[model samples]
Target: MASSRLYLSAKSAAALDAELMSSGGFSLDQLMELAGLSCAQAVYKSHPPESKRNVLIIAGPGNNGGDGLVAARHLKLFGYDPVVYYPKRPNKDIYNRLFTQLSNLKVSFTDDVNKAITETDQILDAIFGFSFQPPIRDPFVQVIRLLESTEKPVISVDIPSSWNVDSGPPKSGELGAAFMPDVLVSLTAPKPAAKFFKGRHFLGGRFVSKEIAKKWGFSLPDYPGVDQIVELPADNEKL
Candidate 1:
C-alpha cells in the first residue's frame, strides 16, 4: 500500500540532497535558498493577518544558521520583520555569503538571545541541524530554554535543536527541558526525526516541505507546496 503517511530517514534525506545537487543541477547555496524559501512560505501561512507578526530566528554558526539567514531574507521580502539572533558567527565560506546577503538586505541582528525570544511571536530554531552530536549545552541549551519559555509557536528548520536526527530521541536532562516545535520545516525531504520523535511521544509538530516534495514527485496539499516547489521547474529552465 502506498501509505497516506510517508516517513523519511536521515540517510534518505542525505541521498536526496546529493541527487538534487548532482543530477538536478542545483548548487548547495541554491538548495539552502530553496529550503529557506520553503520555510518562509509556511510561516507566512500560519501567521494571522492583522498583527505584524515577528519572526525571531535563532541562528548558530553553521549551515543551519545559513538556512535561517536565507529564510530571514525571504521573510523580509514578504514584508515580515525577521530578527536574527546570532549566538556565534558562522565559520563556513557558504555562511560568509549568507552573512553578506543579510548585511546587504539590512535585516536586523542581535546577540541578546533572550531579548529576541521575548519580542517575537514565531521562533525559527536554526541553532542546530541534523549533523549535531549529543550533550547539547551552553548557548544552545540556553536558546532551548528560551524557545520553551517563549510559549510562542516555534518552527524548526530541518530539525529541532537537542534532537538526534538518527536516534529520534530528545536530549536528556537540561536539554530535554525545552519545548517541542509546533512545526519542523524539513529541507528537501521529510525526516525520521520530525516524524517519529514527535509521533512516538505524542509531542505535536507538522513536517513541512516545499523543495524536496517537488524533486521527489510528492506534494504537500495543505501548505504552499505549489507556489514554492512547483514553480522551481520554471526557475530551473531560466538557467
Candidate 2:
C-alpha cells in the first residue's frame, strides 16, 4: 500500500511556516515553543532523564538554534541537566530573550564544545534546518566533526546539520555514516531527507491546523492523549 504520510520539500515547508503565522494566526515564538517542547518530550520518551541526564545541545545561528535554546529550557524542566553550546549567537530580540530564560534556569552555556560533549550523556543536534545550504563553514565544521566522532546518542532536530533537506546526507564524503543520528525529531512534518535517517524517528510540532493540513494535502497521525510527539516507523521506502 502507498504510504499516507507526506514529506515536504524545502519550499513547501517554508510556505507552510509562513501560512501558519499569517493564516493560522500563530506567532513564531508560539510555534518554536511547541516545537521545542515536543522535541523535549520525544527525547524524554526515547532516552529518558534517568538514562541520559546530562544533555549537550549544539545550537547554530538561525531559527533552528532558537529551537535548540527552547528545547534546552524544556529539557531542564523535564529533569534533564541540559547545557548549551551556541557558537554563533544571533543578535535578535527573541534569541536574547531565550538566552535570558535559559540563564535564569541556571543552564550553563559553554564555550568549549569538546569539553561539553565529553561531559554530557547525549547530544541534541539543532545546528541546521531545511534552509541550510552547502559548504559547511568555520566553527561548525569542527562541531560537526566532533558530533561525527562522538559515541553518545544524538537526537537531531528537524533535518540533521549539513544534510541536504531533500537528498539526505552527502552521498560520498567524510561526513557520512558516522555522523548519522540515533534519533530524529522532525518538526511539523518530516522532510524528504528523513527517508535516509536510519534511527528512531519521531514527529513533533503539533500545531498544524486542519485547514493547513487540507491546504498542504497531508494528514498527521493521531497523537495519543496529551502527548506532544509520536514515534514514526522506520520504513525508508514509505517516507
Candidate 3:
C-alpha cells in the first residue's frame, strides 16, 4: 500500500526531535517512555509474550539505548522476561535514572552477548537510531555481526543498527540479509531508511500532537482505541 504519511529524513528527524523538546514541551524522559512503550506494544502485537517470552534487548550508549531501557521495563510489566545488554552505558542523569528503574524491577542485565542471544527467544535491536553514523566500532561490531547471523527474530527500533538513516542499509559485503529485522517499529514517524525495510512495519510514538504534525507537514495514521502503535502495510513504495 502506498502510504500518505510522511517519511522523515535524518536531518528532519533531528529537527522534529528538537522541536518536540523546545516548543512541544516534552521532556526527554517523557518522550522516551512513550516511544519505548509503543515499541513494546508493537513487539507484543507481532511477537507475543506467550511465544517470545525471553527478549534480549541490545542497547547502545545514546538515546536509542535509553528507548531500549524503557522498552525493557515495559516489556517486563507485560509479562515478557527482558534481559538488557547495554555494553557502553552513558553517564547521563536520565540514562542512570532509567537504569535504576529497571534495576528496581529486578530485570536481568548480561554482559555475555552470545549467551544472552542463545537464551533469548527474540531480540530487540535498539542499539542505534536515526542519529547513527557509519563505520561500526568495536564491541558493537561483534554485536551487529552476531545479530546479522542469528536465527532468532529481530525487531529494530526507529532504524536498524549500522544502517544510514537516510540511505537505508549498507552497500553489500558490509552487512547482509540476516541483519534485516523481521519487524520494525518506527517512532514518531517512519525515517527515510524505513523505505527500504521489508517486514512487518509499525508506526509508534503516538504522542505527536496535531499542531506538531501539521507543522512538520506529516500526517499520522489514526491509532485504534487505546493503542500505542498502528501497523502499516508491508508495502514500502511510499514509506
lDDT of every predicted structure (CA atoms): 0.67, 0.87, 0.89
Candidate 2 TM-score to native: 0.95
Please give the range of 10 consecutive residues that has the lowest summed lDDT in model 1: 230-239
Candidate number with the higher lDDT (1 or 2):
2
- Candidate 3 residues lying further than 4 Å off, grouped into runs, are 1-5, 176-178, 236-239
Q: On residues 1-239, what C-alpha lDDT tens digit does candidate 1 reach at each position? A: 13223344666666766777876687889878777776777677656424646889888777788888888888888888889988688577888788888889998998888877778878877888777777776777777777776788887777777777766646455564456777666665445565443411111112334665555544454333354532111111121
lDDT of 3 at 22: 96
Candidate 1 stretches greater than 4 Å from native: 1-5, 171-174, 196-225, 229-239
Clashing pairs in 2: none
Query: Which model, 2 or 3, shows the larger lDDT?
Result: 3
lDDT of 3 by residue, 1-239 (tens): 23434788889999999999999999888999999998899889988999889999999999899999999999999999999999999889999999999999999999999999999999999998999986778799999999889999999999989899988888888853347999999999888888889889999958999989878877778799999999987764443
How high is each candidate's TM-score? 0.78, 0.95, 0.95
lDDT score, candidate 3, position 7? 80
lDDT per residue for candidate 2 within 1-239, as digits (tens), equals 23334888889899999999997899999988998898888889878999989999999999899999999999999999999999899899999999999999999999999999999999999999999987888899889899888899999999888899988887666564357999999999888898888989999856787778767867677788999898887873343
